[model samples]
Target chain A: MLNTLFSGDFPRSRWLTGLLLLIAVALLLAPFLFPGSRPLDTAAKVCIFIVLVASYDLLLGYTGVVSFAHTVFFGMGAYGAAIALAKVGPGWGALLTGGALGVLSAMVLALLIALFSLRVRAIFFAMVTLAVASAFAILVSQLFHITGGEDGLSYSLPRELTPAFRLVQDKVFDVRIDGRLLTYYLVLTACAGLFLGLLRLVNSPFGRVLQAIRENEFRAEALGYRTVLYRTLASCIAAGVAALAGVMMAVWARYTGPETTLSMDIMVNILLMVVIGGMGTLYGAVVGATLFVLAQNYLQTLMAGLSSAVSGVPVLPNLFAPDRWLLWLGVLFILSVYFFPTGLVGRLRGTGSGR
Target chain B: MSGSFESLLARLRGGDGARRSGLLLIVALMLLALAGVGSLPTWITLTLAGLAMGMMVFIMASGLTLVFGLMDVLNFGHGAFISLGAFVGVSVMAALGPWMESASLAVNLAAVLAGAIIGMVVTGLFGYVFERLVVMPVYGNHLKQILITMGGLIVVEQLIYVVWGPDAIPIPRPETLKGALTFGDVVLEKYRLLAVAVGLVIFATMTAVLTRTKIGLLVRAGVENSEMVESLGYPVTRLFIAVFIAGSALAGLGGVMWGLYEEVITAHMGMSVMVMVFIVVIIGGLGSVEGCFLGALLVGLMNNYVAYLAPKMALGSSILLMVVILMWRPEGLLPVAKGR
Candidate 1:
């Protein structure tokens, strides 16, 4: 599988490979080495968002499409799984069935939207998608009987995946790892596999064509490539993979809602992640998502210290408050876009030129 | 009906050709349909309500329309201006409670004007900093523009929360603008009437500035061919800054009006308006102020009428309106005549 993935490469892609390998190793060892649930949970979230953001990059970075409807696909995956699990109850059978159904439905939705709107100018298509996607979110919440409305639906996971189904009660390295650790590992492996799959797809000939389309749509059309079909296919593929990420999100959080899964905030976050990690570079997704989720998880506590330090200062405490980390994240996002348009990965590769 | 409205708007915006009339005629027909479902008085009330809402939307969206039209900047952070305006206006009004509570119309109007002036000035000044610090970096890169502007929005919203507190705050209408005006069996809310009047004044001012003056001429010419205007030795850069400041001020003004209309302000209020603003901008044409006016009115009327007639469909009505509009005219209701 590695040979197949690397076959077309010129073999100059060393740094990204090394970085990705380092992350993979860290994720594998996290359960044993990480001491607390907070960090572990954050790690798991980073994993899910890595796939989610990379799939978005597939469209934005690769195919030169800016879609605002990505979270809808992500939401569909969670909702599909949540609704299915609610109906089928919890088991390996239920999980697989619901997850498969969820992923497939998300792909279908993406495909339909792409096919319908891809013909318009890029900006107009974006607006159409935005309106449609927001409507979908509202519709989901309004379907109170089926969707549980604003409350959102949560269902049980398989018993073996639950924390109570412990392989052992205690831990090594002062880490009390057991069934919950197993869940993290489950999420890790799935996420890693999905990330690898995305990397391979982007490195493949199809991905090269997508890059070509992004570089110059008319030139690609002149070369006889079916641009619309390719874009639509890319959208479908990205959506399918995003749905997989969504399934993992549901499995991890055991909950999904409009705010968590379908909000425009999440959509913007994914966009920021992809851009900050660097567009057109697959590893950027992992790097960006990891950076973002970590910052979100840890920045508040970091800010909390600052807030308290400034407590003696009038008005400074409020400005430095922990809850205002999103404000900081926003600043970081803008700064990254301005100074590191190639993103962290791109800068790491010593390519500072903007995408 | 469509033709008449288009011609009217064409004359108003100084465009030579008739634009799409579907929106105006369709909106009128929708009102007619609503009249069939409810009493005449009910329809009139809803119509007035919609016009007021539409007026507010236009006030907010016109700035966006002009900025996008002139600079080609897809400002995702336009919401920040709105939020800033609301916060500034509310803060000013909160501090001037006694003036607002005065029974004298002149005094009440003074307080409101004071609030709006402060809101506009502060937002305009912030627009300068925002343009320099944030927007300047991502010039000509739409993707980066969107991402960075959104970042600007988030930071500004957080700042608002820090400054104004996260909870929604009430901002009552001035005493003189607080009640309704009744004419026999038909009644009109005073605030709505004020909104309509203010909307018209803003629209007229915008039209006059765009059509009658040198800056307006340059802006219109810039919209048609910015490079050409630049080749004529005009400082397009300065013009860009002026337009940005103007657009920010307009958004602030609209925000103040909207806050008063809703009687509550929050950090996320800007976001709530962003969707409708975008919808209106799209339906109007990316850069056409006149189309923005028509589109806002259409969305406003449709939203109110539909909410009253079918509450379940209300959430999707504006979106559905956009879809319908797109189906009929893919380039928008009245696309810029040249290269968009």
Candidate 2:
């Protein structure tokens, strides 16, 4: 299995494979290496988002459908799991039931949308999805009985994943790897596995047909490919994967909310991740998610420091105000889209990088 | 020059017949209002409220459709113009505090108009710069347009924070504009009536200009075929830029109206209202102004009616309507004759 994974042009080239392996190893050992709660949490966030963005990439990068409803499926997965646990209490059975339900619901919604909207103009489809996604978020928030309204749903996670449990009494590398460490590893491994699975899926003939459809719908249709069915299938798969990402997020946080999951903000963040990481490249999600999560967490602090550093002269020192961090991020996002359409992963991989 | 301008303005105000979709929408709204509302006074109240809401929405959304029709530019940053216009209006009101405090309706109205004019001028200038810097390079590519313009919106939103602080500013309605006029307990807001009137004026002007005048001819022609228009020796790019400026101005004007309607201004106000604006645009058909007007009315009426009936579902009303409309007519209610 390992030889086939390594040998069958599975991950672009040996250099990329080495880099991906290194990143995976680092993520697996993040808790021990970082030895801090904040860093571990951030890394975990990066992991969850990697799964989310990679799932998004399947639709956006592979199938070429710009769906605003991606976050709705994500939110559904989180809420589904959270609500399930809240009702039945925490156990493997509850988790499995919730995960299955979430995946099932996401696929259902995706199919409905694909069937209804797949034949429309691309922009029209995007607009319809935006409207649907926004309505879904609003509905979730308003259904206070089920979704806990704006406060969102929180419930007990599986005991092994909770922070109360400790696997070791002593510290390794001056870090306490508690049950939270176990959770972090779970997220890391799950994300890595999902990423690799996506890699294999995208490299398959199905993905090639989707790409051909994206490049030229008319030509793809002329070739006797039922583009709509292929797109719908791709959307359903993406929705399921995104829901799994949502399950991971809910498990990691032990909570789910409209603000955190269902909002357009998350949808926009996912889009940014894919675009900046390089759309079309499965590995791009990993890099984009990491880059975004880290930047979002610390960019403001860095800006504050820079502003204070320039306080003596006070010449545009407010350029890096924490509140204005988005301004800079927006500028950077635009510049990247204009200059680095291939993204960091694509650049590193070099010419004609699977665009 | 002044006589010509007046004639042009007159042509704009001339009544034009509604298209098939527009007429159908009006009939549906009337029928639904009658069916759901029951009482005459309640129906009137709801209709007036919906009318006013629809008008405010139309002012904001008209710019988006015009721009899209003219340029095929998906300007996600359009919200920035709206918010800026609102903030500018607030500042104008603040500066002309004495006038705003006046009980004289004429004085108060003039002050509000002054603020609107200032907002429009400033937003138009900003729109020019925004177009040049953010939208020019990424023309013709929808994907890039969405990404870049979204980035532009973020930058502008943050800039608003830097300028206005991260607090929601209270927008005080002018003294004369406050309160209501009641006819046998059928209370109608003074500002809302004014908003409806303003909306009509704008709509008439837009219709007149689009249908009757030389520039209107160019715009309509350009909307149908910009390449052909360009081939006809007219600078279509220049026409597109002018439309952008006008659209931004309208957004600013609408923002001022919405700010007064809400009695508040925040950096994210434009973003919040954008949901409604985008919905209205989609429901109206991507490039049709008349469609936007009809769509806004439907959405506004549905929102008010549903809020009265089931408040929880009120938020989702417009979206539900759009879904239904799209189910029936996949393109939109009143799709333009442009090649999709």
Candidate 3:
């Protein structure tokens, strides 16, 4: 089946493959090049977001379901991991347990939601998910004693859990052992593995069915496909992957809060990444995440500088600053919708497709 | 007719009647439970709050319903327009505060008019752009519409944050509309009443326009069947633009009312109120103005009352209502007329 699928002279050329390999290698090594503390952490965090955005694309871009509450899965993972680590002690065991619990929680929630709302297409589905996620956030926040309310939960976990894995040692360079650096490698590896797995899934017959549903659900149903089942499964997988990213986040941040789990802002960010990068394209998720995070970081820095420069004056700083980054993001979204509706990747493909 | 009445009476006297009575009894018991368990005061407060909040909801829903009715587009970014209105209204009020204070009521009215005009213009421009750029391409494509509009929402939200800053800003209510009014034991905020009044006025005016005016007729016709309206020589594209602008303006109006009622405006208002607004739209039935009104009122009441009864369960009530409605009437309480 796989051979038949790739029988028509593989679409990608040797040069393209080589270039992709180089980019992947560069990305893997990029964190090590960053000397500073914050920049390296930021780079690692961006990878987590890239994983998140990609997982979101699995359902949204590929399966054609616009979920407004995808972050709930991620949050579950984070909280689950945090609880596991706090209660069971930090080790590989806790990490794996946290991941399993997160995925299980998402699966159960997705199943419940899917049973009812999966049959409803488009806006109804979006609204239902939004309601569910919002309710979850509210419930979590209100249960102040357990979830810690708005302030969130924090704990201490060591970086070098397995000392034998330290392959490099250079004390002359004043390289301090940082947990964040180790966390970054682990996340990178996980994201890469997941990305490859998603690639395989998208290439499978199951994926074709999903795409068929996206193109025309009625037609797919007419052809005897169970559209709801496929969609539900896709949502489950997407949620599980998102949970994986969430676990990484909890380990990295050492804190979990209501805001982390049930935030519409995060939902918006993920949506923006998918749309801006390009729907139906795997690399777009990473591209969009990179652009969004870097732009936001730089915008804030510039805004802060401008604000300080005009300290004596009462005028608001530049509109494109970090504080005002949401405005820019909003504008970008509108512009993308209006002018470049297909998004960056779509726009690029348009030239080749001669559309 | 006598035989029919007798049969009806017989049925009422039988097991069917018993079942009906049982159902009614259950409903009555639930209501009593709601009232007896200290839920009445909470319900009243929530109802009032919902009513207060419903005014804005109605405004937003009016526009949303019309757009959905006329064009089968589920505008995900509708909240952005509401946010735009709030930001613009607050900024204008803040800017013109001094000028309005020294001037007469007419000047105050003028400031308000100016604020509304600004909101309408800005939000209309946004609508026009959205229709032409975002909506025009994905006319029948729901998935594409969802993606593009979701993107549009983010862009609009970020733009507001950039222009207005991240923090919430206060938009001063007029001096005459600043405080709460005491009626017996009830203390109602004056601005909320004003908001409701404004909402009613707009609702009435919109109703009139749809029923009486030429454009209104076209809109109504379009809602029923755009192709038929187009075949009759009306410019349906222009109608779409007009509807988009009008809908956006309603959202803006809602935002302004919200700013006044809450006494604070933030970039996040669009997102914060999004779920409730969606609930209103969904419950009211997509593309029905009357449905929007009823939905908003129901939601407002439920929202306020539920909070009062179980302060911790504020979010649960809306979801529960939605679930029940969806299960019973999936097409909503007032589904848009079909095959028009």
Candidate 4:
């Protein structure tokens, strides 16, 4: 029965299942093979970004809502978790509490925005969200007493649950373990759970309604479906998932600030990952996150090498470093929109061989 | 007087009268209140500053509005054009400093002209290339448009950084316009005054071209119904190029003025000012030139007032204005009429 449920006549499902299993195995073996703080750290960060991009795709690709303020929820979650750990305590209970608070806040905010701007569509929704996010950034930044102003807030965490679990030095087999490996496993577990949840949701009746609304909201409304309600629910869920990623980020980074919480860069990064990988496809999120992280790392390395080779030329190697990355990204985005609207994964699926 | 005011209001609200008088009356009252408060600046100074700032905002917002209204392209790299214009203009002026000093007024005017030319040519070329290569592909797809434009923005910004470096560069202000003008205790910067004058000239020229020229007519027609215009065999693609060029040039011109106003140019200016320009365009009804003018003034004043109130709030005033606008008029103050 399980095989029949999993296996469909379409070859795409078989390929997808196979690819997913391969990825799962690779994720499980990553820590043991890499055995380093940096590699594990990168892997963990990639997982967090994957979750973030997937959440963004949930709304943009599936629901057709271009939410500009998605970062606000993510930021809130980071701060929520940070505050909880700092003011309250760092434990599983605290993490759950922080996630719950972030989700509730996001849901309330989504409800208010949706209720007010439900009549407006497309670009109008984008603009309003942009405004709200900007306002939120300013509000948080200005409240220095709480938000730590531009300097940002900092807090120390209690000792790990088991000091022996550290990825860098071990006593049993003389293998080293440290926080990076721990973070990697934690993030990977979260991502896999969320992925399963999202897959189930997308295949359910509720997901069909979302697709119908995305295709034509007016027609869906005429059919007696409450489009706004469904959209709001999807948006809230996306926000919650994004918040989960944010919480993980805060825990991993061990530092939170306005820049980390609500920068436009985060929004751009999430958007790029989702679009580049493929929209409306779960695997697209994974692909986008992987590609974006790898490409950015490679580009920075290349730039750094060039800067070092040319003596006396001060080349700033930062996230906001002046480079052709943005230009290439822009060109790629335009090309994707024009030639491959379904994204790289979608195109591959169309070929009938990838499946 | 009260009876006449009420009648005039009724007529304007009913769309029977032009509402020009009502607008003037409101402007007059605002000016009076600004002066009478003693807390604010003199009426003339406030109005002059507001109008000048408004004019620049209008220039920036017009291009943004046009692209959004006509093609539904978000044009995320709109700021790149502005930064490009400023950098190019300032560089030209710096290069020609000797000639400008010897022939002061002539040199300054020439620099302004040169800046406008460079800004228009370079940015127009960019617009054309971008439209054909980047924008053309993502015509109706919002996600692709957003991604590609954003990517373009990052690339352009990085390129600027590579060329100009990270530090802000100070452009030499015209020697003749270095001092401030004092009007009975109210002091105004001469460059700002010059900016106001130049902005007005550009506004007038744009208005004339858009309203009077044949190309302008086609642009209007294109905006209203792009498919119909294409079907008529009017070289719709060429028309799009013209519109893109003109819009980009306008942005470049605004960038020149911005460089002069700020006295320093940085690569991040494009992204920083983008949100404000977006707000102005949305408020101005997306496609209406006249609406752009009105929207710019409203945003400019609101921005200044917000700055005035910032000491108390800690954050800048624009954020507050954004929230208020989002809450009250999410479609913007003047939503474009559906179906063009």
Best candidate per TM-score, number? 2
Q: How does model 3 score by TM-score?
A: 0.84
Highest DockQ model number? 1
Off-target runs (Cα >4 Å) in candidate 1 are A5-18, A166-179, A351-355, B1-20, B183-185
lDDT of 4 by residue, A1-355 (tens): 6434322212264554565556557667777766656666667777788788888888988888888888998988888777777667667677668667876787688777766665555666676677677778877877777767777666555456233446455443444555445666777888878766776676678888888988888899999999988988888788888888888788777778888779887787777788888888777887778778867767766665654566454544442342546655755665676667777667667765643
* lDDT score for candidate 3 against the true structure: 0.75
Instruction: Report the candidate with higher TM-score, 3 versus 4.
Output: 4
| Candidate 4: residue A115 lDDT (0-100) | 64
lDDT of 2 by residue, A1-355 (tens): 9744522434554556676777677777887777778888888998899889998998888777888899999988888898899888999799889988998999999998887778766777676777788789878877888889999888988888788887888877787757888888888888878877877777778888988987888899999999999999999999999999999988988889988899877887898899888888888887788889999999889999988887876445656677677778778889989999878777767743443
- Per-residue lDDT tens digits for candidate 3, residues B1-340, read 9988967854753524433443453355346546654545443444456677777789877888789888889887888898999889778877898745643556776777788779878888888887887778888877778767777777777667656766888667776666677655566776677677777888899889987899999987788788998999989988888898889888887877777777788877877777888887887677878667767776666666656556777678878877776776575666665445
For model 1, what is the error of residue A79's alpha carbon versus the real structure, in angstroms, after optimal superposition?
1.4
* Reference-based lDDT, residue A102, model 4: 72
Return the clash pairs for model 1, or none. none
Q: What lDDT, from 0 to 1, does candidate 1 have? A: 0.84
Could you give candidate 2's per-residue lDDT for residues B1-340 as a string of tens digits? Answer: 9988866744553312235656677778778767887887777777788889989999999999989988998788889999999999889988999999998999999999999999999999999999999899999988788878888888888888777778999988999889988899588888989999999999999999998999999998888788888988999999999999999999999999999999999988898788888888988888889888988888888887777767888758787787777777776766666633
Candidate 3, which segments miss by more than 4 Å at Cα? Answer: A1-19, A30-36, A87-94, A162-182, A258-262, A296-317, A325-355, B1-46, B95-118, B211-214
lDDT of 1 by residue, A193-244 (tens): 8877887888888998999999899999899999998999999999999999
What is the descending TM-score order? Answer: 2, 1, 4, 3
lDDT of 4 by residue, B318-339 (tens): 5454455556656555555434
Error of 1 at A215 (Å): 1.6
